[model samples]
Target: MKSNINVVFFLFIWGFLLACTKAADPGSTVIIDPVVDVDYSDTSLRLQDVAPFPIGASVSFNHLSNDPKLAAILYANFNELVFNSELKHGALVKADGSFDFTTADAFVDLAKDMDIYGHVLAWHRHQGTSYLNTLVGNLEQQELLLDPGFEKSTTVGSPYWFVLNSGDPKGTATIAVTTQTDEVKSGTSALKVVNPTAYGTADWRVQVASNNFQTVPGQKYVIRYTAKSLSGSGIIMVSAQAMDGSGVTHYPGGDKTITGEWQTITLSFTPTKENYRIVFNMGKKADTYLVDDVSVYSEVAAPDYAAIYTRLDEALHTFIGTTVGRYKDRIRKWEVVNEMFTDAGEIRSNANSPAPIVDGQKEYGYFIWSEFLKRDYGYLAFRYAEEADPTAELYINDYGLEYSDKKIDSLIAYVNEIRKRGAKVDGIGTQMHIDIHLSQAKIDKMFQKLASTGLKVRVSELDIRITNSSTPMPPTEALLEKQKEQYQRVVASYMKFVPPAQRAGIAVWGVLDQYNWQYNGGSDYPNLFSTEYKKKPAYGGFLMGLSEK
Candidate 1:
């Protein structure tokens, strides 16, 4: 009986071990504590709630527009949307003058309920170059002078001539075209210069020259003009002076004394520079001179600006009619003209070479546009933009305005000048693509100055970078914290400086760091979101800034 009982105990122990082994098997059920659901969304702040004005992001049309996560973030946080490149002139207008508004339309359709900011109506870089070239191709190959007769004038000054006086302290010299009908040599009018004060400086003379005349170096050219003195007989120095930013090089074409009767003076010389202005200098004696029918011609023809103006006007009208008019309801704010000046506060000149090609044709270089339209291009762009969308708020958008005080000053002057010319400019766009290392004082000063302009100011394309070089390393937590501080400071500066009425809004450059253009080949943590679409500290910092009074 004892042996049988011990056997049963052994069998029971073996069965219990087998049961334990089965419980520990891979397929065995295991109970765990219930996971406490933590909501990350509660810690997040809505951008629009913090911002006094509209909060916006520059969005790409592809995935950002449709992706559930991105769309959720954008829709929930932003009330305004600016397309990264969809609404640009190049994207909208095709090479054949036909518009492919597919991308732009898609963007508009997506953001139809939100406020849409049109990127640019006219920009030298992103134009439909092929269409623009086609408009001016024939004129580009030929040499022609504009308004040679000095007949057309909507204002007091002559259309194509820039009148300058040297050594006159009282500024008595004045330029006008005589409309008396009898003073003209060939046409109905003559360029009339009245200089009452005589200053004895050798360079002290009344000068009239063609503003946009192109001359080839080492190329022969003939200049002919008819002139007569009304009061005093004096020798008028005729020369072809190259008006390149470097000191003027005066190519002598000899001098001719003008009497009472109209005398035709012909001068022939080869220019030493590419851009030559045919200058007529009336010597020191104060007198009234009448000059007419000025003609300049080279063996190789130059651009005919009068005809070119017609084509350019047509092109501009077409562009405005198609893009601005089509989406007038959706897009009410436009960067009418963009990047007109460089960082040095100088008007950007495309004199050296043509801008990079877009759509298989050379973009409209700055020199070409300035030469054709003179300073009226900006005015005309604004005018047409206003005409297309009468309610649209127009802005002159430029980069480097924040750090470069001189650039901001110049841009202010430019905007004022455009407004003075009867063009409607509602705001100025300062593209604050800056580094965290930039002086906070300088940034504050910039916002102050911009606000002083009294026009609505928009901090367009706001991206703060921590890295300096294209080859970026993984940013440290400290560096990211610095970036967050900067982002907060920028938003706070904008809020404190920019008046509420004049606040056009701010647009973050992009949604993610991985997609930032500054991220050359490596990591650049510039944006408020990480590659995984999680909001970074900078996002909260931006919110904190806007939350401030």
Candidate 2:
């Protein structure tokens, strides 16, 4: 009877174990189709073999170092390698002014080993804020004007300067130097201009004259001063004028709207005369204006509009010299300036954009660099890249130009403009990230437009999305076939439109569908290969496209 009880207990334990196994087994409930792997080596044609230009891909340095599969795919398919993020400004320069090049060194070493061409030298975005701000701070502290902070005072007024009431003599505007500690914007004193009543004449003004110093003629000078209003709202017309024997001639300055908060106004001018005076026309309003920290000096001594631009241009050159100078022997192609324009066909402006805060201090962005450099920013970038790597083919790269006519036109115009400014741009890179459904005619037109510029054209970042906006449908056989045909047409169109000489190369943006950045919501197949390093049907399509006349 005891033996019988032991057998029953054993059976009960076996039943519980079976139940647990069944619950843990996910394949038992769902059907998973086996993936058929296709070795690209076994294929009739490879991407690197059939292409006239060097076939390239933008690769992640981390993945290139860590993932053997990714490295194998890149090595087999591509002859040229472009880093997606590793070589950008922010990656190279650290906050402490030292460069971290462990990843970059590894990448270059791999490129050297694999016989892959290293492309790209400089780009605009992802720059180190702390390093750049330090440069700006150093220039700002270099004082040029005498008693710029309004700390020194004389019997006449502020040291080395005096107040003048010009224009309508009948106007009831008064001026004085104030030592009010609380009201001053900087130092222990400020220049106060009070207009008690509104003047009938528009030219009624209060001016500040330099007593001993005089501006150099035909030299760039920066005039910077702090100003605020006693009332919450008023308008102050500010101008830097040459008060010579002839008369007062206004330099390049404008009106400033004042609120309760203290604001610094900086202006740049090339003086026509040796002696100049800064004029603060406040007779139009019946309000008190408090001004402090007035300064006037050559562009080299101060950070004005032109000086900021000069410094930025120098910085760009320095960055390129440091980076490209180090790797020019290995890298022969560069995307000098990347994505300078917005999708709306406008230059990216930082006039009102939010500034980046580093260590609790706000720093300038790339837009500020662009603003200071103006249209010459691109010119300087290309020039600097060439100076660093003279043999490298520099290309200006931008996205959305392929789809939009306005954007393409703007890009062409910009290229021409830069060329006119003596920048020797070698190629134009159109980031062809398009949907499969986009018109082939539009793509052909974009290629033609780029070709007309007489510069080498590169289809820089090529990737096609196979999904609609709403959902990412599974990659059915029919959809895969359709995607294959679309890839064939694109490759064929590129070959057909671009002359063989001007075709710099076509680079696949990414290697595998699973690793594609476009696959955000669900499973979307966009690349020529699968996650398991198997060539998809799109691979065949690319080969066929190359085979065409």
Candidate 3:
């Protein structure tokens, strides 16, 4: 069975490459007579023997399902890694702050049940400030002496402590109750003891915490919430606190009146230190405080090449044995989640920071992306993906880890942050787009820092554009060679750090130049193959470099 397949594979690729190069490489273009038959009895050679995993390719879902042979061809030629934008965290978290685990959870379950590996989590934005307000309110309230450190006294004691009944001479003090075991029985039961005298002057003591401070040091996090006062009026205070070995520290806070109509609040913070806890308290002495959909989270980390690799593990398995099943393993090798970053191609900082990349300034990217890397979803997504697919390799795919120092620096910090939190990120992808003028030494040092975390590395997206900056496109041979050299240096540096077993692989963005995204130029024409499906000169150069001992 193996021998027959090998004969077929050799015949096909040999014929294909031969046909493709007939006009150029005359020595390799000699046409064999079709009538000359050769015996292929030995089935010893296998696909894995030639290439352990197939050279992978990236394709939109629409393409794979639309073409029957294309899927099989991908499975035969390479291992697969998929780019699924739907599994990102922003889409997963609901407006109420609790995760809308439906799609993400389904993706994970399908990976296990189907055996394809891919992303279970991504660094999409998640700001549940509305839900987080309530969370912080609860956390801050916990810090203060909200309950007086004891339950209500059933028997009468001092006037300061005795439970007062409705209209019992004392000024009316509204009290809210939250029944944990069961829903509160309303009417008079929910308001059994409202001190009538307690309300005249603000003498009663109730704890109030700031509703704002929400963060997780070195772990990306976000939270938001919206709630309505079902029946009564109450002053709600919320705040943030640091959870120390001793207890919570209340600081920086906010509050508002939760009117009967639903009120929405948003809270976004990245904790560089351990001060990422939120607390809340209700001021009404005797009002039933009803809360719903309280949400809390560390910030969501942006998807870098490293994280993309991690997510692919689950994606591969999820697609296995399904219509897209055969390409699962290949997809695990080199899948590109295009534009996973913000439109400007940078990670977002906290909510207050600008969206994605603001005006292409490195500061804007750093301000937001740094916060994201340090404490946002950087840790959580890795944790989940690691648990979901232990054997599958993963990467955080991105478009601009190459020429941008701010991006590179933040990425390093982000990688470090996740490492501190114990993530299994295996590599860093510098989506090679333009011909970067980075010093080899500087690039080497960056890899060294990333390697210190003990991860594999990759040049996830390798495109070279030499068109106008105003209207960017692919490059000419002269331009492409320079781009190729840039890629060669990067791949070379990456090879220095990665061990053979850990090396999943590297890939060109597209097979044909025409199909490549040169039109979106930052010096396009970076691909090793031309638009006509012919290997560019760089293709031979890369094959030689990659094959070097």
Candidate 4:
């Protein structure tokens, strides 16, 4: 009878809240539900009581930063900080392999000196190999494949190509190209003839020397040709001239041979103060080659060593300065450089070198996505960060530490080497990205061994991917009970290490399964929250342990 009364009271309160009238009150209204007493309890319960710290929830910079209420809730609750950054560009080591540190230095100076932390170092994955390969291939090889029609294409800054009058090879192969200064154009729109197309003579070539064009260096250009061979192999060479404004007389030259298949060629070259021209030739007879599609940009410059450090500095500032920057603060130690030690630990893997594949491993090569961190950039990046923030800890994070005890032993040895070489080493971030079933015991033990290094241990970016389901799995009564038990077990285990402080805080990689890396969580259960952000059994279990409020 008491239970039935409680249910009736709940509905009454629900209806009152739902039926509140702004028509009469306008601003706010209150609702009330009657309390009822129940019989002596006989309910079963599981998990220890929650002891929520005085702190609130973690502040996420991306979304929650915009909400004042949520932000206040976090500030009042959790002391954790989080910050995002704008150092989108990574510092480039120069072509000569020297650090410039201009861009990076500026950003870092702002952070380290100013006591900011929102923009600590990040890997900046936007320029991954897939993106770079496309940029390089298109600019260097495919840009030159344009068809030159009778209507000449715009040459506000296109390389000058000699379009020979197909009628015959005369001293006047009309150079119908546009120049910026208009020095080449005559009264009726005829351009001056430098090295005009000749019948069959010396390997004749006409090129738009990469002269004084007001554009970024290393821009891509398309060298196109529409040619008809009358007699000789109609060869048209589009070579980027060496930039040294020597009256177009002393131009550095290389020749690109054109085929009879009406082809367009692309060249990715850096332009200098020297004159660049498009040279055309027929080797023996009179033929014509027309051209189009020329452009320039400033994206791919030689490594700006200075800029690398400047950006690093900026990232550090954003990471530590704002409320959003709190996430980085909690990360007392971070993965400075990514991957350092292979199973062998000798041949570095960053600059496109291969890693030694484990025996019977199907994947071979250094930097294999599934295996190694694949390079030393992770190390170098960490070093720069340590210099900027001398006190805060730093680390080299990687996966595949499960090869054997030998691998972890080698990493320790490797960190020692880096420290000897002036790197401020702190700890290792082992990504527990795989499903728990694959190697749960090994994963747990790996943490134990890594902690033995005397450096901090973090379950950085932890997420167990469940790929099979799009919606929440209906928890069987048994499964819900099991989930509660499992969460309690994990939490309790971590509490054991509280005495030593060797283990820092553990963070779920994302808030929910939907936001996690495995967008489609496979068969494995992931996260303490459901996809909708509603608390799940795991959440209640965790909060029960964390909150004593």
lDDT: which candidate is best? 1
Can you write out model 3's per-residue Cα lDDT over 351-449, one digit (the tens) per residue? 444556546422321222234233435555456445554555556656555445566666666666667778766666655665545567766765665
lDDT of 4 by residue, 367-463 (tens): 2221122334444555556655566767656555644566677777777667777777766666555442344456556766776677766545444
Q: For model 4, what is the error of residue 397's alpha carbon versus the real structure, in angstroms, after optimal superposition?
A: 3.0
Residue 16 Cα positional deviation in candidate 2, in Å, after optimal superposition: 73
Residue 516's lDDT within candidate 3 is 61
Which residue pairs overlap in candidate 2's backbone?
none
Per-prediction TM-score to the true structure, in the order listed: 0.61, 0.60, 0.43, 0.47
Mind giving the per-residue lDDT tens digits that candidate 1 earns over 1-549? Answer: 123223434565556557677567757554421111212134364676445577778878986756778787777777788888787767777778888988888788898467888887777765676677777754323334576777766223444777666336634677777887777777577787777765444534677667567776787788778888876486677777776776666645555778888888877888777787777777466777888877887754676778988888888878876788998877878888887776788665565334667775454532245546657777888888888888888999989876787788888998898888888999998888888888889889988998999999998899988876666768678888888889889988997898889999998888777778786555577888877888888886786666444
The segments of candidate 2 whose C-alpha lies over 4 angstroms from its true place after superposition are 1-44, 113-124, 134-303, 351-368, 468-470, 521-523
Please list the C-alpha lDDT of all candidates, in the order they appear. Answer: 0.74, 0.71, 0.44, 0.41
Descending-lDDT candidate ranking: 1, 2, 3, 4
Question: Residue 377 error for model 3, in Å?
Answer: 2.3
Backbone clashes, candidate 4: 99
- How do the residues 1-549 of candidate 2 rate in per-residue lDDT, one tens digit apiece? 123223434555556557667566645453221111223234554577546567778778877788889888887777778777778777788876677888888888877433333344444456776676665553443345566666677322655666666335643566766887777887678777777766534734555565445776887777787888988576676566666775756645566778888988888888788776666677666788887887777765545666666666777888777887888777777788877776667665565334567775455334245656767778888888878878888898888877778778887899899888888899899888876787878888988889888899998888877765647787788888878888888888888888878988888888888667786645578888877788888888876677545
